[model samples]
Target: MSRSTFVATIEPVSTCPVNCEACPVSRRDIEQPKARLMSLAVAGAVASRLRHEFGVGYAAFGNWGEPLVHPQIVELLAIFKQVGIGSLYLTSSLSARIDAAALVESALDYLDISISGVTAEVYNIGHRNGDWERVEGNMHALAKARRESASRLKIGLRWHRYRHNEQQFDAARELAEQLGFEFKPYFGHLGGIEAHEDFERGTLPQSKRRFIENSVFLEYVERAVAAHVGEGSCPQAENLIIHSDGRLLHCCALMDSHKTGIDFLALPRRVLESFKRAPNSHCGSCLAKGWSGFMHSSKVDHRSPAEVAAELAPSSAS
Candidate 1:
């Protein structure tokens, strides 16, 4: 049987200009210059592995780091195309440095941009200002790039929805249509200062709180699980993140200290081992009844004993 995994290259930068209300990384506030970009050598080595060792005919170049910030990103992508191996996916904040003509030449299979809202003010509440214009400009450029590329380069929007910008739904949908990209709204599990503060002050109001509680949220979770399971070919298995430092994590949603890092280049067995051993804390929580951790219950493997019992119990017969 042929097995496949979505190879996500996690490039981490030290700094981001945004101050969004749902920022996940604790280090977002550090008064420091941007972190170092991953060296071309490291990227090239990973590319080589994707082609040869992993037999990964499908790969992506973005995850943690802003692909736009890595000056060598385009170059690395070019090399991947040259190798004539697999599809390439690029996830970006749609910052300004994106070049339509150049990226179009990269022969990407899919391109996804993260857009939270249609207006700067709405986006600014969570992210920094320097990005607003650039993100907008990049979106336009990507639209053009998608049109020009010979290969079917899918352009799509990954919207991280928040209460402050919930009203942007219609406008964002319109923008997606105008930009020639598919729109996908995602409620982020993480929040920034403003969102946290609002929740703390009991300001989230009854309606919004109820929205979070209603079956709609469950439906979203189901969709997310179905999508992942479809892609992975395993409902119990999951997507994970292996950082540049070789840290194995249970995806960004359940990111925490319970991680394992090793030189995946030198130790492929270790990589597989970590996958078996390092199930996310959220996974454990999923086994506990009434647990409502970040890993949405609907996304959990419902075949588990707890889930089976809950579904088959007499009380649930009604």
Candidate 2:
């Protein structure tokens, strides 16, 4: 988020192929203009700028959607390598092809597979319409690949925590360890999890709630140290968050069209300069809370190709 050290977060697609019922994007009413898939040129250019110019060390290929779903995902990784990106991280649901053989041989630094429960029925509560059988099969494939390839990929089975699935942590961890993968648990926002107890009761305090309801500024600092994400003066960020379509995002959590700010494709240089000058207002706490007294925003496709081309084309506006 700062000018000194920046990281790149890209969502290759707004819509995921898997229909996880609890996923916010699965809400049929939600709509945001998303790229059909990340174009090779855009991926290459962004990676180059961050690595060659800004000296970024890593590029995470996922944010909201599954990164592996990209048709050219491996190719995209090649772009990062080509541009001197130091490392790569990928997060996926493992609902589709989990070609472990290919993955173990790739240049990825980390691979996180999100799973909520161990059993098919239990996993379905969070994953919704998921196949536990398929997950197990793919994980075995991954383990086999790791054994054969001697890969150093930091593979982990990320468990999204919920009231029901919390009990399965031990078995899940054991399974992960057996398969040469670490088992991690995290509270997903979609499970309606929050950072505080105030969310559950109807009487959420008005004062502590001002950050989202009335957030003043996104706190960003380089080399400055502090405590939490809500802490402003602390040097917290390592990357410049952006959508593949070119909106310079405030953070990975808030991707809704309204929340995303600046069209980077049209004014790449200008947007970079603007973010350095001004703190992001749409991030940190939140600004999209509604009748439920909770944060919510639903838009992702923010590319403006026509405008981007106009800027690059030989025109007087340039």
Candidate 3:
């Protein structure tokens, strides 16, 4: 008999190394709870089952927390690789300590390093309590690992823009390129600054509406941002973000109480079907309050995950 496990966008640890002005978890200034890391045994069992059923490269590793903070991360990855899981994908704040040797040797196929500002003061404004030098050092270390291993790992950096840090944009992009990594810039969510439920109303609040209108971030990633949110937003009613535990949230951005997700493993197929079929209350703001777009959840985006993976995978053409 097989001991069962379930696949999810795993969060091995529920801790963020750096506090940001826009992150909901970090906004609790008074008596915030400590971070929670998932049980390695639980993660291993799920990964094994997914590997048995779907083969390698079928799961994503990071969602909300810093996966690098898990003390046994190397071993955790080794289990998946042992079972033949392919192309582990993860994104991080690059604020956590990195084990370069372990990371390069593991199953991590893709890593997206997040940066908010280019200059020290400005970068700290968003990254709060972060050290620019340390982040830069980690970036170099990751690049070094890729070079030394002659590995197939792909690394990229994303800069989430804000009004205060707009001046540092070009410099950061240039630095990322010089470091031999892809540089992407996008506008960030403003809802985290207020009550998490505020955005759930599906319509913009006057303050947030005004902020979006004047934000420097809007000028940089207008089209991309629009595609993901606001008018003509991409429909993601089927997409959900899963926590280290089995808890799920409707949209990646919404973490409030209204749209409580069904435990993925408790009724895996049913939950997944529900996840794939309809829009929930939590996604209203992300769809720009358009009920019509919400109704389009079952519509196909015309690309499957496998197709996306193949596109990103190195060309096998000879």
Best by TM-score: 2
Q: What tens-digit string does per-residue lDDT give for candidate 1 at 1-318?
A: 367554444443423444333443333332222346656666666667656665556655554456666666677676666655567787777664767777766667788887766778777655544468878887887778667666477887877654455567777878999988887766544332222233346764443333333312333333444443322122223333445544444444332322433455666744654564555444443333222232333222313223333543222112
Whole-model Cα lDDT per candidate? 0.53, 0.58, 0.58
Question: What is the overall TM-score of model 1 with all chains considered together?
Answer: 0.67
Location of the lowest summed lDDT over 10 successive residues in candidate 2: 216-225
For residue 216, model 3's alpha carbon misses the true position, in angstroms, by 5.0
lDDT of 3 by residue, 167-189 (tens): 67678778888878887765554
What lDDT would candidate 3 get against the real structure? 0.58
- Residue 119, candidate 2: how far off, in angstroms? 1.0
Q: Write the per-residue lDDT of candidate 2 for residues 93-201, one digit (tens) a residue.
A: 8776666677777878898888878899788665665677887788888888888877788897876654455457677778888988876654333312122223334
- The backbone clash count of each candidate, in order, is 12, 8, 3
Judging by lDDT, tell me the better candidate of 1 and 2: 2
Flag regions of model 2 displaced more than 4 Å: 1-4, 190-230, 233-238, 257-270, 276-318
User: Which pairs clash inside model 2?
Assistant: 6-239, 7-238, 7-239, 7-240, 33-301, 34-301, 256-299, 257-299
